[model samples]
Target: MTIDDHKSHLITLGKFLKQFQTSNSVMNSDIPGNNKFFEEMNQKIDSAIHHNGWFTRENIIFALQQWSEALTPRNLKLWLGEYDLSESGDKTVGIVMAGNIPLVGFHDFLSVLVSGHKVLVKLSTNDRQLLPVIASYLMHLDSRYENRIRFTDNRMKDFDAVIATGSNNTARYFEYYFKDKPSIIRKNRNSVAIITGNETKEELEKLSEDIFRYYGLGCRNVSKLYVPENYDFDSFFKAMYKWNPIINQDKYANNYDYNKAVYLMSEFKLLDNGFLMLKEDESFGSPIATLFYEKYQDEKELKDRLKENEEKIQCIVKKESNTNEVTFGQTQKPQLWDYADNIDTIDFLSKL
Candidate 1:
């Protein structure tokens, strides 16, 4: 099959995904194979929720919605236009997905396949239910995909190159194991927001989505805040009121309570809103139900510090910044071309 063939299959899969864009799924009759696949897809969503508490229905649907928007014919063309896929080498690529959020490693999977390479994927135990169903849908759209996509439960071998995402510890293992091969081994990284005192309330409200989406499980979620010294957090906490319902989830509330207790016992100062805790910390990666923050006296110094530590950050959220800052509320809604860790997946796959 040609590059257009792979693109067409993905476009069809995107149409199927559009049906489940929201928790209240509405099947579209125009979608091919919808009658056979729609019900099973919904069933798998339920199974994913049961298997991993973090995979909530709303979050799963949110991921599907983002992908549906991303996989349009125009979006795909614009994204792939920069590369010459016709000359892309046909090698087998192995992908190790991270289950931190629903469909987290899909872009890498899509990259390998669309770049004219076969993919051998090892699904994270926490995210196993969804992507294979997607693969099945693609295969149903065209038989050729059956030969190109494969998932493994055991050790993976026979791949020319690999892309793996995991914690800092596992990243070391991936680096050593794939040292002889071309690979992209991703380590732990977090996103942060620079809170100017003058941000509109609307922007802060939108920033709440960046903090609370997926209950802040995704690496793209804003885990830290850099605010000016003596900045009042009244407006910030008020803006975050919309996500108060998130605390109703047992797992989140338990974390909030436990972390709050630990902070109190340790005599650390904190700002509490009954659902989320704000603690002054210099770290980028914060624990769930808590947001770490640091007081920045100078904007220039803060940017320089962040730039120096780019390896530890996945994204920066700010307004009117010249650097590669993600707009507020958009950390989770990255475009198809927005490569993670600033690494180009297509470029890596094309080289392989």
Candidate 2:
């Protein structure tokens, strides 16, 4: 499709999303009868939880809005560039979806759609419902999209290119399997932070959203902290305590217990007032209920270390530091201009 065509497609999808948000009465039902979209989203969220018993509807909506905003025509054109519909098309693109977190595969889906390529999406069992629902909604807005999209339980070998998302371990298998084809295989990654100055309670609360949202399963979730020596942990914990409701969910509680017990048995000193854990380490990523960290005093040394570790950190949340723009709960929520690995999707598709 041409750039115009891609833009039109996104506008149509956005309209459909807006309509869905308007017409559906079950979107965000968690907050009582708030808004139609929220209610509908809440229903889907509830169903997803009932089916998988893993994520909350709020997190799912948060992710959906993030993608929807990113895929807006203005943002898409900026990040993906204008599509060239006149260019020769690739045969098909095989997308292996990852279900470790909700809607993690949508960016690739948007790329396939805007590029006018046939997409054969192998849905992750953990996220089998949302994609189909989204596809159905898109088809309602533009039936043309229907012919280009396909969901399959079985893998087919005929494809011009592939994009697979998985853990660092599974990426090796994907590399071997799709090595002959042009592909982008994503391995596991986690985000981190550098705390230098005093943070307001609001900022810390928002940071807590990034830390606890989706139960720390997402790549953008901050799993590690870099704080100055003798930093007062009490202030940070006091600010973060507002989100204690996050632990109320049974699933999150289970994760907390499992990890906390393991740490205790291993003789790890948890920075806890009976809720969360903070440990000191060099790694950026950690499992739920625990955090890893390193102490830094010199700003130059911290910046150098962060630069060295850039490849491993998807995001670095910092206060009064020289780095990328930092936001609190918005870690997982990327804008349209935020290109993944700084690669322009449309440019890549056009080349293909």
Best candidate according to TM-score: 1
| Per-residue lDDT of candidate 1, residues 238-315 (tens digit) | 999999999999999999999999999999999999999999998999999999999998998998999999999999
Model 1, position 139: C-alpha lDDT score: 86
Model 2: per-residue Cα lDDT over 1-352, one tens digit each:
4556657656655543442332242333332223423334445656776677665666666666666666576776666554455574655888998886777788888777767788889988888767776776566556777788888898656789888888889899999999899888887778887776478887787888878877888887889988888888888899878777867888778878898888889998778755578877666778777778778889788878878866676777765423464667678777765555556655666667
Cα lDDT of candidate 1 equals 0.91
- Give me candidate 2's TM-score against the actual structure: 0.87
Model 1 has a clash total of 0
